[model samples]
Structure formats: structure tokens, C-alpha cells
Target chain A: MASKFETPQVRKFPIIPKLENSATSHLSPFKSKEEFQSSLGYPGELVENWQEKAIDKMGDLLGKYRSLRVYLDSCIQCGACTDKCHYYQGTKDPNNMPVGRQNLMRSVYRRYFTLPGKYFPKLVGAKDLTKEVLDDWYSYYHQCSQCRRCAVFCPIGIDTAEISMAAREVMDSIGVGQKYCNEIIGKVHKIGNNLGLPEPALADTLEGLEEDVLDDTEIDVKFPLDVKDSEVLLVTPSADFFAEPHVDGLIGYAKVFHQAGISWTLSSHASEAANFGMFIGSYDNMKKLAMRIREAALELNVKRIVFGECGHAWRVAYSFLNTLAGPFDFLDPRYPVPQHICEITNGLIDQNVLNFDKSANDDMTLTYHDSCNVARASSMGGIMGGQFTIPRKIIQTVANNFYDMDDETIKEKTYCCGGGGGLLTDDLMELRVKGALPRMEALKHLIEEKGVTHMAAICAICKSQFSKVFQYYDLELDQIVSLHQLVSNALIMNKKEV
Target chain B: MSFVTILYAAMFYFAAAILFIGLAYRVYEYAKIPAPLKIPTPPAPMTQKGVAIRIFREVVFFESLFSATKWTWLFSWIFHLALLLAAFRHLKYFTDPVWFWVSFELVQVAGHYAAYLMLAGLLGLLARRVFVDRVRYISSPSDYLILVLIIAIAGSGLMMKWFPSDILAIKLFFVGLLTFNFSELPSDVVLLIHLSLVIALMIIFPYSKLLHAPGLFFSPTRNQVDNARSKRHVANWAKRMESTK
Candidate 1:
């Protein structure tokens, strides 16, 4: 797992290397327990005749999800996506390649479903659903960040992310699930958030945040929780409650809400925005998790809903929430069903309602890293390219020096932070570090050439990922800053009097 | 009626039947499958008209491949475009007096160059699979064989064009077959080989990776609009779940 190739001093595109055997086969996440698996409606253990069950599930999925069937049948192996994956680029493993990873399940799909593969498996590169094949699927599929980078470049739009998701769903149905995602999902079901920070702890955290904001500025900005009849219910990731930089972003949201005189409260029932069900590819689980927001909104009678900084969460909310828990007729129809906090702040900025003393961020030169989910899965301002522009617009408005990385590495072409798609656990540390190579290389270029002292990201996962993986490249952990943290630093609270 | 003509007429009919029926079944399967969620790669088009234009650009221009790697795109585009021209030009054999468009001098000239380009493009693509480390690693035997098969078909066709085989007999044979009358077929070795290879490609089209032709149109991630928030997209099974709830 060591850096097999020379670390490029500046960011460059990943070149195809000679394929190595077992480059990452040793990497696998801890398996979930029986209770954890059953909690999410999966089997307690590997079921009897799991092969048949897995194949049946694959067939069920093929019927239920059109993307799976199309993608499975469509690949011509032209290798357009061969070098598109960050893990393959970093690991030099053919299995990490998008097509290679997909074939882990695609091969079995071929064997059981296609006539040629059923008759002549070896000729078609198809294999039976053996235990070894299942283990490989678990390993390689987890390595993918579900970023859809390869899907963008594929001629037929064969998304490996869809294949990975289907494979995970199949595994879970067979009583094989990743401990990190399944356990977190169980926590969300039992308690309200992944952290299991109960109502008292959440109240305690908000109290500390409110005191901190007042200590910094004379104005007492409120961080309300479970307050009924609030105009807006803010749903943010639990990491923002405790983690540095993320916590600063949380405080920034509070100040923005205070300055705008908007009554917003966080729902303890739906305290966290991150949805691990999306990572594990379970629609039932994802929908169950998403339904909490709708329930909380109706119960609290909030007119609107606004989501905080979380990558995949925003994707689920922006792209899947309406279908999962819809008919939000009780809420305000004037706003976007669930507006992104960036859009809210940007709207306020556009209205000249919020003031920023840009010089407050003079200590830093910054570049924005677009989270994969936000960059590719959802948009802001209901326009194309809004996702890419809205965050950078906010950053430039708040900070003095903002330079973008190479065009190829930004916007829709952005690399995953490597810790996404539920691979953020310590069990997959090597994959996380190596997978961070592409984005890290981009950051290194900005640091050396553009005087980019810090990189701001909207997602909590990207912030946590860069903070941990920066050490491997001899970069400081503090180099990863939150976009709202920058906004927090620059906002002039006393501007209303001026 | 010659024995060779009868044999070829029957072969073409069988191959065409398999190709059409098989492709139709596969396409129906793809179309019937429910897309439970909205997952279009963004910045996706918002309207149905926009998505159609997007797919048209992808099919005609290979836009995604053009952005991915210029080398693959160049070879793939040349092969596909030239293949289209070469196939269209060959329509003269099945039509009596030929379609008016095929009679154009420009079309005739383009067809000749297209055949040459097709051969050149196939060879370049085959070379990439052979030499490129990443491509070579992922290439199965069928992948390489598919390329070799196409190269053979193109090579044989080019030989007949350059050597001036019994074109009148070949055209009469195809035209007679279409009209349910048999004619003496060309016994020229190159023409026979070319016809056999073309028949094989058609028979194998639906069963093999050639399904990508239809699969591209059905791909949900590429074809769906990025308007999940504005309009709810619930699949049939998802609707059933709601009803049960």
C-alpha cells in the first residue's frame, strides 16, 4: 500500500501503470454483527443458500433498478474509464478500475443470467457466486467512493457507482454488511444521529456554541434545538457538533440565521444529515432515514427546511428526499423543498442582508474542493453549474484570495476525498490514504503554485478526510478548512448599526 | 436458382430474424425495468428536450469519450462514423436501381474513403488493446476476438472493393434474395468471405457487447433529467411500498 510510484511534485493526471495482483485485496472492512444487520431488516447472518439468495436479490434489483440492468449489459470494455478512478490510479490494481470492480458482481450476473456465460463461463470471464467472489466484491466495492467520476467519462454512461451500490445491497441482503455503515445506521434508528448524541448532549453542545459565539462577538446568537414553530428546521451532520472546523461552520450558520432574523431550530429527532443507508445502497434504509426530516418538519410546524454541510446527505435530500418522503405541502412552498445552507447564505448575500469584512480572512489563501456528491449529484439555485459556482461565489465574497485548482480536477471532474461512500472508517485507512492521492496532488499544486494556504470544502467527510490523509503527504492537517468557517471568520456582526 | 444463392438467402433470413428478435427482447427488458431513484450525472439537462439533445450529442459526437481520452475517442469516432457510411453505401445491393441518395457522386466517393478509414480505425483500436497496459489488462478474449472479427470483415470488404470482384452477380444475388427470387451468386472467394462475416456479425449482435448500441439509449443515469426536487419520480414498486404503508 506504500506509494508505488514517485509522488508527482505537482498535480498531473494519473497515468496507467502495469496492473499489480492483490494490490488491495488485503483491504476489507469489519463485518457487521447480527443485531446490527437485523436492525436494518437484513438477515442475522449469511443465510442458508446465500448464493441463491444473492442471485435472487441481483435479479430483484435488476428488475427494480433500470440503471443496474442497463449498466450491467452495456460495458464494451473499451477502457474509457480505465484511468478515471482515484483508487485504481493510486493502487495500480486492475480490480480498483471501474470495470474491474463492476465485474466482481457483473461476472456472477453474467454466469447466472446470460446464456453464453451460463454455458461457457470461462470464455466470457464469468464466475459462479462463490465465497471467494463474494469476499472480493466486499473488498473492491468498498474501495469505490461512489463519486461517478468514471460514469461521466464512460461513453455509454456505465456508472460503476450503481454497480457498487447494487453489490452492497446484495451483500447486505445475504447478511454480509460493513460494520461502519450498518452500525451507524443502527445508531440513527435507535438514537437520532450516527454519534448517538442524545437530546441532553445535543443541548449541551448548542449551549457551548452559543456561549462561544457571544464571547467572540458581543451579540448573543442562538443555536436552538427542538424548538417548535420555528420558521426553518436546520438539519446538519453530527460531526459539525464536535469536530473542529466543522463546529466553526455550525457557528457560522447560527450567526447567518441571527443576522437575517430568521427563526431556525435543529430537530433532535433528525439531528444528523449524513445518511449511511445511501452508502450501503438500501432504499428502504435510506428512505427510513430520510423520512425523519419530514416527520420533524410536520411536528415542529416549520415553514421551510434547510440542509447543512454534508455531501451524500445533500445528494439524498436534494435528489431522493421528495420521492422518499414527499408531499411536503405542510411546509412553505415559496422556498426550494430543502434549500442548501450555501444557497440561503448566498441569497442573503445577494439581497445585501449579510455583510462580510473580507480582510478577516487575510491570513489565508484558499481554494475550494467541490464535494463529489454536491458537484455531480445535486445543484443549487436550480440551474446547471450552480453547484460549482454557488460555493465559490460565497468563498470569493468572504475571502480575499481564492484561486481554483486545475480545471480538469475541479467542478464535475472533481476527485473523491477517498473517505466517502462509507469508507471513512479506520479499518480502511490504507485505501483512504492512497485514494486521497489525486485530490492531494491537486492540493499540493495549489499550495506550491497558487499560494493556496488552505482548502475549503462544504462536506464534513471531505474535511475529515483531508485532515487525516494530509499527514501522509507531509501536509498540515489544519490546511483543510470549512467554507462556512471562512464565512464565519469574515462576517461583520456589527454591520447592522453601521 | 443456384445452391450458393439458396444457402445465403436462408442464412441471411435466419441471421436477420435472430438479430431483430433478440435485440427487441433485450431492449424491452431494459425499458420495463423500474428506475427507483433519480440519478443523472450532473450538470444534467433539466428538460426532456434537453436530455434528447444530450443523448444525440453523445451518440453522434461521442462527447463523453471526447472529454475522457482523446486517443480512444479519435479511434472510436473514426470507426463508428466510417462504419455508418460503409453500411449506408452497401444499401445499393438490396435496392433495385438504388435509392436516389446513394446515387450521389459525393456519397460514392465518401463510401470508398470510409471503407479505408474503417480499416485504419479498427487496426488502431486493436493496437491500443494490444499495447496499452490498462486496456490490455481489462481486455478479455472476447474483447480481442470481437476486434479481430470486425477487422476481418472490414479487410475482406476492402479487398473486394480494391480488386473489382463480380459486383453485378453479388448485387443481383442480394436483390433477388430480397424479392424472394434466387439468382446465381458470385463464387468469388473474397465476396463470399465478406458476406459470411457480415452475417456472423448480425447474428452475434444481440448476444454480445454490441448491445451497447441500444443500452446507451436506456441508461438511466445518462438519460434521466436532473429535476428530482421539482418533480417526484417514484417507481411502481416504490409506489406499492407507499400504498402498503
Candidate 2:
């Protein structure tokens, strides 16, 4: 859906002035269908006493996560995080400000849990949990991409992502789940991936990819599926099987594996890497989905697991996989139990195992968009700042011309793709476009100043987002390419076979 | 002791009890609650030593705030540093023989200037809330009220400092309270107002956002190491779930 507000043209990415309630408060995603909600073991519909249930969930959460409890109590409202949110920067909605969005629940929290809010609600800005308040929670929490950019700047380290996740979890407990997240989570539960592509369909897609690779390179290449006794299990996003430039990334992964001569297989059982449970902030769901990869690894007897290019998926796989589904003692200890493709690629490059004809990608001048989750949540190569380096190192090795966007927007302080944190659904398209404004502005400057023609991203969500949102900012759709797409182009296949 | 002395003594005891007990409970709750995952915002340090260094820089220098916005960093650091010095100066009243540092004239002079600096910093913060659009939008009455309360406390304390009070009597009053012996409080208007505001601040410190004093240490984002892959950190509840599995 086109943004209802006037979209700004690209020129130094226009800073939106505060318009005092500029963003309409009522813009919300469609509710989850009853079947979708129940599939994840949540209530099938809004419970009889949803308010009480929601409050009970909040209480349960407060007891569980120290981050939630302390963050609720710790905010001094010093306003360091006020302008940090991309949604707030784009929409100028006061409610979108990290603190303002947090206050939606904090106000209600104060009313019920704190003495001042109980005795002097008006003085403390506390309010009861009304239907309108719940509506506000749904609308605003969805607007957040859970990027954690605000947390980096917050003096007290209050993460708005934590608050937003907690809010979504509370909403789900009351049967008010978002259709995008909960539905995909259900797909992940039943089918192996988010697309709900059944086993036969997944096998067909992989076979088609192999045929395409052979046709292009004129050499023998394999995309093995569910092959037991493989050395590595490649758990990648299902989008890589269907969507471009994501599929191009998948081809790149295949080439890297081929060049390195590593025996790797994709499992039809755990065919997906993107975990939607993280988006909805459900630990049980997250853990349940993570268990699939472990199952797939054991069933296939694979020694190592490697995640392909998806932003938040890498975060879950890198940061939480061991905790959720671990003790992967069966896997090869020579490598990390789960390694990022970039890290593996970087390692191969370091060892001179792969070769790239840099001139092959000479047509495109490129810059990299550091996907928020990968930039801020996950690392590469067991080092600090490897997340920033590994992908860039891969790009520079394969691509001739490369320029970074603004230094501020490149590293740990990177902006979200506006479509992350499960806001990738078509229903939240308006919010996505607006949220993308900051990153797009940085990209615009790179295009103008450095003549950069393409922006390569590692995350599937980021690639899809930039492809869609670029048109709004007067940039062509093809300007967004997968980081591995660059690698695929420059990858020189075995001349002897050809 | 007169009726006023007894009432003042009771007020001090009440405020002290609330402040200590409330803070104790909040901090206890924070310590007891488990962080279920390792979510240190990257590019965070990977080692425990690195995390300690990071937190030390965050606390002592306000490094994150400095990088985010210099104006905020300046104002907040000024207020915090000055408040720390002023609080240190007040140690003279509680200690049997004032600590050597507090007894020094140099430190006393710094404490004197700190009150004025604290007031200026509070005003700058208050003005930002009034003018900065984004910050203004997020400002609630309590946000403004908290600043105003601290400002009043500093302002009243300055008045007593500028126009001298019955220092011996006030010191004796605090010492008496500390040692559990009742004593008559000084009969100075500015001193009384300052004491009342200080008491009010102490009572509200635990309930209000002042909990940030303790909460920052417990914040997982700031305090956690970036070694999630190397070490699997599952909370107690999560481990229990794993057991069932």
C-alpha cells in the first residue's frame, strides 16, 4: 500500500519536522486469524477477560525478564533517546518516540504496580489499561522495528526493542497477535519455513536452482537436499529458494561451498533460517522453532550448521541458538556449531581457497547497508566489529568499486531497513516506507556524491525492503543487490569443467 | 526537646526508612530476576573484563551520552558530578569524625560551587524539555516535576549556604539522628525548607525514575558481554523448560 502521507523526494533525505500528531494513531496491522493464533499454542481468540489476562502476562514478564522490570522503572526521561527512533524521525509522531511508545505500557504499569501511579495517577502520567490503550499498544509497538538504535544512545541502556517485544508478547497472551508474525510462526511450526513450502515443493525449488546454476556457469554444481552424512547443514531463509536477489545469494553460497570443496546439504525438515518467533518475542515459540535445526542436523548427521544471509535469522542463530537448542556436541568442534556464511566466506578468502574476478562486477558501483539486527545483535568470526568487516571484506574482494554510506550509518549505529522486526508484512507498508527514510537518505547521499549505483545488503528483509522503498525515494529497484549477489557475479567457475 | 524537635526527628526517621527500604527492595528485585538471554548491544566487548571496562566508562564518563549528544552529556554530567560532590560533602554530618576528604577546605569549596553547578544543569535540562520538540513531546508533568524538585532542593540549600545557618545545631541534629539520640533542630527558615526538600527527595528516590542509579548496573544491554556464542547463558526458567524437553 502507498503511504497515505506525502513521500519526500531524495535530496539529503529530508528531516521531517515535528508536526504534532502527524502520524495518524489508528494505523494498525490486521489482527491474527484465530487459527493462526491457536497454531502457536496461544488462545484461539480474544479471551473473555483479555484485560486481566494482558495484565497477568505483564506481571509474569516482569518477574521473568530483569530487562523489562528495570527498564520500566529506570527511565529518567532524560530525552537522549527521543530523536533516535527512525519512526519518530520519519513520522514525527510523539507516540513513536522511544520514551513515548514505552510510556504507553509504562503509564498503565504505573497505574497498577506503582504507589505513585496508584495514588496520584495524574501527577505521574499513569493511565488505566483501556481498550483505547490496547489499540495504541498494537499500533505503536508494530511501528517499532526493534532495531535497538535507541538503546545504544540511552544513558541508562533502556532498550525500546525490549519494551516493544514485551508489549507484543503481552498482546499475544491476550489473543491479539499480529497476522504477519503469528502466521509465519505457524508456517514455521507446520511447514519447515515461513513460506509454508512443503517438502516436495522445497525439493523442486532446490532442483530448479541447481539447473539455473549449471545453465549460467556451464559447469557441474550441486544443491543437495536432506542428504544424510553431509559435513555441513546450510539452514537458510526459504526466500532464498524463490525470491531474487536472495536466490542469487543462495547461488553464491553454493559457489562458495563448491570452490571450497565442502560437502554441505540443505535439510527439507529445517528448510528455513528466518525465525518469526523472535519478531513476536515469544521465547517458547522461538525455542520451539530453533529445535528444528538441531533435529535436522541430527537426522542428516551433519557436522556443522551454517546460516545464510538473513538479518534477524543470523541474530537468533548466532546469539540464541545454543541457549535454545544447544549442547551441539555432535557437531564438528573444528568450526563454530553455527557459522555465518560471511564468516565462512571470509575464512575461505583468507586461506585463498576461493577466487574472484573483481572486473566481473565492474559495471556496478556499490555500498553496503548494515542490516540492523546483524549490525547490533550478531557478530562474525568471533570478534568485535567482525559483523561490519566480514561482509565488507567479501564485497571488496569480489567487487571493483565500493563506497560506504555515511560513516554514522554504517557500523554498530546502523539504521533499520524499516521492514525488520516483523513489520515486513504488506499491511505495515506505510510504516516501513517511513521508517526507511533515514537509511534511504544516507543512501541518497552516497548515490549523489560517490555515484554509487547499487546498495548491497546481507539480510533478505533489507534487500526486499530497499527494492520496494527505493522507488518511493526516486531510486530504481535494481539498485538493491544481495552482498552475495555481488560475489556470485565475480565468482569465476572452474574453467577446466566448462 | 520541644514539639518541633520531636516532629522533625520523626520526619527524618520516616524518610530514611522509606529511602533505604524502598531502594533495597528495588535492587533486590533486579538482582533476583534472571536475564534469560545474552543481548549485549553489539559492537559490545566480548570478555567479562571488557564488559567491566565498558560499564566503567559508561558510569564514570557518560561515554554513550557524549557520543549521542554533547549538550545532553554536558548537562547530565555536570548535574551528576555536582550532585556527587554535594552528597559527599554531606558525609560530614553523618560520620562520627568527618571523613578526611570531606573535612578538607578544598573539597568544601568544591561542594559549595557544586550546588550552583547542579542548579544550572537542572535548568538547562528543564529548558530543553520546554523547547526541544522531540524531547518536549515526551515530557510528562512528572518529568518536569522531578527536575523542579531537584532544583528547589539545590536552590534552598544554596540559600542556607550563602546566608549562614546554625551550623553546629544542624550538624548536632543529624549526628543525633544517626546515633539514635533526639536533638533540637535549627530554627532557620531556609535551613528548614532545605531539610524538608532533601527529605522529600530521599523518600521519592526509590519509587521514581531515580531507580536509574541502581538500574544501570543491572541493564543487560550495558553490562552483558558479547560472548553469547562461546557461552550459553540460559536463565533459571529457561533451564527448567530445557529439563522438561
The fnat scores of all predictions, in order, read: 0.82, 0.80
- Model 1, span A224-261: residue lDDT tens: 99999999999999999999679989988988898888
Q: What is the Å distance of residue A309 in model 2 from its true position?
A: 0.3
Q: After superposition, how far is residue B131 of candidate 2 from its true place, in Å?
A: 1.6
> All candidates' lDDT scores?
0.89, 0.88
User: Model 1 off-target regions past 4 Å?
Assistant: A1-14, A495-498, B162-165, B243-245
Q: Indicate the worst ten consecutive residues by lDDT in candidate 1 chain B.
A: B236-245
B54-139: candidate 1 lDDT, tens digit per residue? 99999999999999989889998999999998877888788898999997888777887898899888888999999988788777
Quote the lDDT for A472 in model 2: 85
Over B1-245, each residue of candidate 2 has an lDDT whose tens digit, in order, gives: 97768878999899999999999999899999999987888658988899899899999999888878888889989999999999888888888788888999988888889999999899999998898887777777888988999999999988875778877778889999988876788777788788888889999999899999999999999999887777878998888778333
Taken in order, the candidates have interface RMSDs of 0.9, 1.1
Off by over 4 Å in 2: A1-4, A11-16, A495-498, B243-245
TM-score of chain A of each: 0.97, 0.98
Q: Residues A150-171, candidate 2: write the lDDT tens digits.
A: 8988988899888899999999
> CAPRI band of model 1?
high
Count of backbone collisions within predicted model 2: 0
- Candidate 2, residue A263: how far the Cα is off, in Å: 0.3
User: Which candidate wins on DockQ?
Assistant: 1
After TM-score superposition, the amount by which residue B120's alpha carbon in candidate 1 deviates from its true location, in angstroms, is 0.9
